[model samples]
Target: MATMCLLNICLVLLFSTEIYSLDCKMLHLQQNKVNMKSLELLSKMGGQFPLQCLNENRNVGFLQKVLRPTESQKENAKLIILEIFQQIFNIFSKNLTQAAWDRSFIQSFQNGLYQQIEQLEKCLHSERENEIPYLGNEKILFPLLKLKKYFERIGDFLKEKQYSLCAWETIRWEMERCLLFVDQLTERLQN
Candidate 1:
């Protein structure tokens, strides 16, 4: 019995130490603004956080392609914001794992992005003749402006080495706000 208990204790310690080591490495990489490839690798290695990937430099070509359908400058501005949201989603979804997913977390994240997408779609569909206005010019521009701050906060959290909890919270906050903004826009257009 004594030997068996000792073996279990040793295994637990070893696994915990391994997890801590991996988290430390992730913290280091996140702080450095490591490239996307490295971020992907760390995420694949069972890292639960997603702050590193979402904050990368925008892909100009991808943004242009995604926004090519819009003709009006105002609509195009909306598309630009949408494109950024999509990029953040792509990065975030790629990094998450089953263990990282909580129902509350996923629902909150999904709802936020869905809301933003809905808003943009509504504006595009409803404002057929009138200029929809650039997002920067919108009456409720505070939401998108808040999103920019979330991105910065995520970056700052990574910099501060709050790898495990802060990073996840940052991701959650960004997703929630973005979705809400989109949802508001969509609902407005439909009515």
Candidate 2:
């Protein structure tokens, strides 16, 4: 009777451990799926978002209220810009490295992104809309320029050893600080 009880207990423990490991594996897979979906949505939205902004319903209305183009908005826009770059960085890291460069895709992605950032900078500068200067006379142009430079460096870094992780880490670190700065600016704007 004692031997039977021990065997049952061991079997139960083993079964529970297997179940937990399976659950963890499933969770990780689901997380990857979600991330992939997000990246896909971003890619689609990248093309559509600017176009949507052009519609009459999009202009001079409640969006201005919700969007609230303050200094904080500019800052937040910068953060989102960085987030977009980081996502691209992650994609590159997953697929390309010192051994291989996804040159065509990277170039195209960066070009599109560069154009979008330029348009956003222009949007910030244009006085026709409810635009505000970001951080004194710097405007939104400075951050866009900086981000452009980073992309250029990333391209150069792709040729070097162990640079895949390094390139991603560099942008990732800056992105956090950018978020914090934007959050502070946002708080001030809210007040």
Candidate 3:
């Protein structure tokens, strides 16, 4: 009887340890997935923004002439921002199954993102100065600024390790709002 009890206790301990380890691994994987999804969404914005700019067919020639001098700077900023996003995505992709949680890395990346947003904003503002009086610059700038805010919120949640469903839904809502503006702007530009 004593021997049987001892065996059962050992078995239970062994099984519990295995289960705990498995749970930890699963949690790590979930975290990685969330991070990767966020990065992918951010990267998509880079392409979407330029496409929106190009969709302004009527302003293409005039705006081009006005922006030609600083065009390279604008493009360079967008490319750099996109590259950074891709780099982060690649890192997350490579270690999808592992938990490479580094607070410093996330902080640095967030700061870089903010810097890029500022740079882009400045470029847009400069272009706005030469925009035709009737063209409402707010249509573009407002959505961009809103997207930046959403990114900041997402980054904060990521840094705090808060991946709640509600948080993600809120981010999604913000994204949709920005996209709606983009669609509206595209329509306006088309007309």
Candidate 4:
């Protein structure tokens, strides 16, 4: 009878261990899926913005004339910012493993993002008063600011060692917000 009781207890412990391992694996997989989807969305949105900006100005003869003097500089700044986004997306795509969420990696990413934000701020500051109407009335600035804030939150997560889906979700939300604003501005410009 004691032997049977010992056998049952052993089996129960083994089964419970297996179940716990399976649960952890599933959670990790879910987190990975969320990260990939978020990164992909960010990549698409980041790539779209520069193209949309270029397209919006294709037929704007009046606006072009007004912005002619500073056009190249403005466009170059936008392209630089776009390149930063592309680089960030590349990093996220390639480093899809759990190590990517490590403190060192997150710190490096945060620094790069902050640099890009500074460049963007400079670009926005350089815009002349007359360029405001053509640039969607400074609608782009808000999204960029919000994105920086979200990145900071991600940095916080890293510092806390809390690599939850919440950080990625926040980033995804900010990216969507930026994309929506850009899309609306593009539509307005097109019309």
Task: Using TM-score, give the best candidate's number.
Answer: 1
lDDT of 3 by residue, 1-191 (tens): 64564355345434543443343223223223333434444444232333322332221112122222232233232322333333333333332122223333333334333333344344445545766632254543443343344445445644443443333333333433432332222232222
Ranking by TM-score: 1, 2, 4, 3
lDDT of 4: 0.37
- The residue pairs that clash in candidate 3, if any, are none
lDDT of each: 0.41, 0.38, 0.35, 0.37
Number of clashing residue pairs, candidate 4: 0
Going through the candidates in order, what is the number of backbone clashes in each?
Answer: 9, 0, 0, 0
User: Which stretches in model 1 have alpha-carbon errors above 4 Å?
Assistant: 1-77, 90-99, 102-150
The C-alpha stretches of model 4 lying farther than 4 A from their native spots are 1-95, 98-150, 158-161, 188-191
Ten consecutive residues with minimal summed lDDT in candidate 4? 57-66
Indicate the worst ten consecutive residues by lDDT in candidate 3.
58-67
Query: Residue 123, candidate 3: how far off, in angstroms?
Result: 1.3
Greater-lDDT candidate between 1 and 2: 1
TM-score for each of the candidates:
0.32, 0.30, 0.26, 0.27
Q: Is candidate 1 or candidate 3 better by TM-score?
A: 1
Of candidate 1, the 10-residue stretch with the lowest lDDT total is: 27-36
What is candidate 1's local distance difference test score? 0.41
